[model samples]
Each structure stands twice: as C-alpha cells, then as structure tokens.
Target: MWKIAVGFALFAGLALYILSKGGDIDMSGEKHGADATHSEAPATAVSAPAAAPAAPAASEAK
Candidate 1:
C-alpha cells in the first residue's frame, strides 16, 4: 500500500537524521568512555568556600 511505503520512507529518513546528529547529544563532561575523571585532584579533599558572608547575624532581641 502507498501508506505503508510512505511510512517506511519517513521512518528511514528519521533514522538517518538521528544517526547523523546523535554524537552532539552526548554530554561532554565526565563520560566513562576513553576520557579521564573530571578533576585532577583526589575526591577526598574538600574545596574552601570562595564567597564571604555579606552581614553578621544579630542574636540579641531589640
């Protein structure tokens, strides 16, 4: 039937499109394949906070 042929053609076109652009869909960071871990340093050490507190808290009631 013409409908079946059209459907098959559409599906083939969609498959080709997906296959062509599929590589860009992957997340570039921290993939298990062939790439090293995200950071050079060990995970155990914690990084210090960069931003200082804006204002000190007032504990005493007015």
Candidate 2:
C-alpha cells in the first residue's frame, strides 16, 4: 500500500539524517586495495602471561 511506501521513506530519511550527524559516515560504497584500510589498526592479540607457582598452604594447629 502507499502507506507502507511513505513509512519506509520517512524511516530511511531519519536513518540518513542520524548517520549524517555522526562523526564518521562513509557512503562511498565498497573499496579495494589501499583504500580499504580502516582508520583504526586491528589490535594485536597479546598472549596471556604464565601463572607463577602457587604458595604452599600453612598447616593447622593440632
């Protein structure tokens, strides 16, 4: 129905307006080669450090 079309248009407009207000909005579609690089570099995955030897528990008084 025409109502559906009008609702879709309004929703799309609101979405576009919100995206425009954002600090970063890339509407240039897909990219390739060097242009595909993201602003932030992928974080290097760090291996967790090995745990130290556990201390021996003290004996309880008899």
Candidate 3:
C-alpha cells in the first residue's frame, strides 16, 4: 500500500513538473482560437436583421 502511494505521488509530481516547464499550458480557460480575441458585436451588427415592433395583443371584453 505504501509503495503504491509513493509511486503515485512521484508520478504526479513528475507530471506536474514537466507541465510547468512546458510553455504551451493554458490555465486561463480562455479560447486560443484565431477569432477568439475579436469582438462579436461587429459581426452580429453586420449580419443581424432589424428588430420589428411587437404587435399589441387583442383584449377579450366580457
């Protein structure tokens, strides 16, 4: 049991060390795609249709 625990600890430590040294790690959880940094507003403005006014609902009179 002790041997297994030690082995697992060592393996985890080694993996963490290697990952820390690697520059490709992205911990920010942000998208790294080419268009990820661009604003969505401009694209939506260009392609979006104009909003139409809502129609008034008919009232039911007794």
Candidate 4:
C-alpha cells in the first residue's frame, strides 16, 4: 500500500513538473517563429465567388 502511494506521488510530481515547464514546449502545432495571424485569409472572403451580372429581361432580348 505504501509503495503504491509513493508511486502515485512520484507520477503526480512528474506531471506537475512537465506542466510547469510547458511554456518551453511548442504545443501550438504551428511552425516555429511563424505568424499565426497571417497563416491564411478569412474563410468567408476566400470561399465567396465574384457576383455575376444580372440576366437580361425577355423584352430587352427582343
């Protein structure tokens, strides 16, 4: 029982240590020194297509 408690304490301590040093780790999944803001244009702006001209009326076609 004491061994199990000691093992758990050690594991918890290691986890806390890793978390404390998390700033040194790049967990952002982005390339190092890359600008996150300029990675890509806005989705709405990119996906939208240019507006087409209005169709001519039947009388106007004649």
Candidate 4 residue lDDT tens string, 1-62: 99999999999999989988886554567653545545356676456788999999999997
Where is model 2 more than 4 Å wrong at Cα?
A: 46-62
lDDT of 3 by residue, 2-62 (tens): 9999999999999999998997765666786683675435644456788999776667433
Taking the tens digit of each residue's C-alpha lDDT, what string does model 2 give over 1-62? 99999999999999988998897778899999999988987899999999999767666433
When superposed on Cα atoms, how far off is each prediction in RMSD? 8.2, 3.6, 10.0, 10.8
Model 2: residue 47 alpha-carbon error in angstroms: 6.2
Q: What is the lDDT of residue 21 in candidate 2?
A: 87
Model 4 quality (TM-score):
0.38
Residue 6 C-alpha lDDT in model 2: 100
What TM-score would candidate 2 get against the native? 0.52
Which one wins on lDDT? 2
As for candidate 1, its clashing pairs are none
Clashes of each: 0, 0, 0, 0
List TM-scores for all candidates, in order. 0.38, 0.52, 0.42, 0.38
Per-residue alpha-carbon lDDT of candidate 1 for residues 1-62, written as tens digits (9 for 90 to 100)? 99999999999999889878886443455566656544455569778889986665576534
Badly placed stretches (over 4 Å) of model 3 are: 27-62
Candidate 3: C-alpha lDDT: 0.78
Worst 10 residues of 1 by lDDT: 24-33
